[model samples]
Target: MESKMVIRQSIGFPRLVKWPRRVGYAAALWSLIFGALGLYWVLGGDGFPFGENDPRGQMMGSYLANLSVHVGGTMIALTGFLGIFAALAMVRKWNQKRLYFLLLFYAWVMCAILLFIIPDSRILQNVAYLFMFYFDLIDWIVIHQVFCMIGGVLWGTTALAYYRISRDACGNCGRAGEGASIISASKWGKVFTYCAVLTALPYGIVRFAWAIGIPLGTENIAIIGDFSGEAILGGLCFGGAILTLALIQKWGEVFPRWCLFIAGKRIPIWLVVIPATSVSVIIFLTGLKVSPQVVMMIINGEITMKNWGEMVPTLSWLPWGLSLGIATIAYYLRRRSRCKHCGKF
Candidate 1:
């Protein structure tokens, strides 16, 4: 029922767009423009075009640098402008839910095909490179295509839901109760804790190896240098994820009494919601960025693509869906409590 309600609210916005939606639209548009520019630069060969070093390589690279970067940037900018316009539409009470959902679905389809077909299938990879400029396009798809689709839709939808919640008869008073004991009331708390630990495992192993001067074989990651852009982006995401989890552990719906510092303090939703939402948004958008290079070992020719297919369901869709759902529910509960306390409704 709540999901249905959200769908209705989302669809209803176009009739009267709001400033908040407008701002989100602006942000989305900015991302789209930046993405387009990046894509264009990639095609023009002005920027770094890896794996292509010959004269033909240089020539192709050069052309893309000139044309795609400029053209792509313009296209991207147009998207950003459109987002701003959409936000205005939202404020004006024009529903944009259908558009947002369609955007997200489109993005998802793109990511799924890219992840499933290209990396594991030699035929697909070769074919894609013929016209797609796979290397740079891959990154562009991850960043702009995916990011805007999810962020625009989710934030737009969430903000609208928040507006509705503000107007409805809420169930809980805004008592950010002593969170010390709140965490133990349900199985969900344990699930969150377990998930957090699982998520941190890879980071822990890598960091530990690094601190001890052990070559963790993190070479493939290319966390430094010309191709370091991916690493930088991933690092930011990983860091944001860590920060979000910490907030959840400390200030979530229920903080255990054994916690320190803000033991009982109600964690600000921005602390948890913003970062959690961000990760969900990014992960969904980027399809987990599981490139051919990243998973080459596991996705080798010996491995049937069908077998590898299972990985996508787990890595790309499931985890983010679970986390997003949980974090959203938490935010809603908190928001409802706050609204009730303030007697806004």
Candidate 2:
């Protein structure tokens, strides 16, 4: 009887914990550590993670690469210090509407800079290379950028928690005194879902054509020197495009009958959300890095109307990422079961 009671208590513990508080504390702790690192750099520490201190920082085109140590370090340290206060305020559920909005703006802007602006295509390229059994491409810089992204995610989570808490909503699920269920939001979800799918087609189609030696957009067949890499990347794009459709499809919620095993079983929500969200961030970062260069090239007349196809597809990544993210959230909202923490569906 005692052992059974202990097991039951252990099982119930997770559901009873206040996740918002925990997430807020985690955000504060991350800010503290990051701030300490900045201070260390300001004090002449050996291995600063940004700008010229990073070996590949220039190649990655990190905006921080140009700043001197003192300037960058001070900025980082200040942001970290401010982040701590922001995180703590969210944790405490501070109810001042004006102050909360200010913090929300700050948090989201920081999140966008960290997650979208700061990172370049190198991170995604490195991951792709790794999957292709090319290990040398994975380096410390990539890991550092990943660390930055983690921090961004934490801040975003803190902002979200604060948003819900301020509105007196269930922190776990964001359900409040509402007129309709989250499933009702699926209408907009489908719109974004299809938008994401359409954006993927251009890149995928061009790559596929190049792989088949067609040179659909470029001038000459020689321009498409090698097709193997193009083929692999094109396949990946198509695969991603297909998987994205699952966001609005019935298969996303349950296993299909075609599967030999686990058919009809409910799919784990995080299983889909985590990968989708990560890919969306990566695509957005890649587009953010490339879009400026592409625009400059167009302005300089280096890339003209005749060759628009080559560069135009790259521009689609930003919107594609954003749409996919919204679609994923919509999928989650539509499929989420009753909240275990707040007892709200």
TM-scores of all predicted structures = 0.44, 0.86
Q: Give the per-residue lDDT digits (tens) of candidate 1, residues 1-345.
A: 433333343444443334333444554454455455545654664532222321232222122223334554455445544444443343333245665555444434433332332122222223234343456434432233344344445334534433433334221322333332334323454465346435534533444443444435443323323323333333443554455455344345444467776576444444456656544544433333333323553656533443432232224333543555465445444332213233342
**In candidate 2, what are the lDDT values of residues 55-159, reduced to their tens digit?**
666555566666688987888899988889888877866657789899888888878877976667788788667656777866666776787899899889888
lDDT of each: 0.40, 0.79
RMSD of each: 12.2, 4.7
Worst 10 residues of 2 by lDDT: 1-10
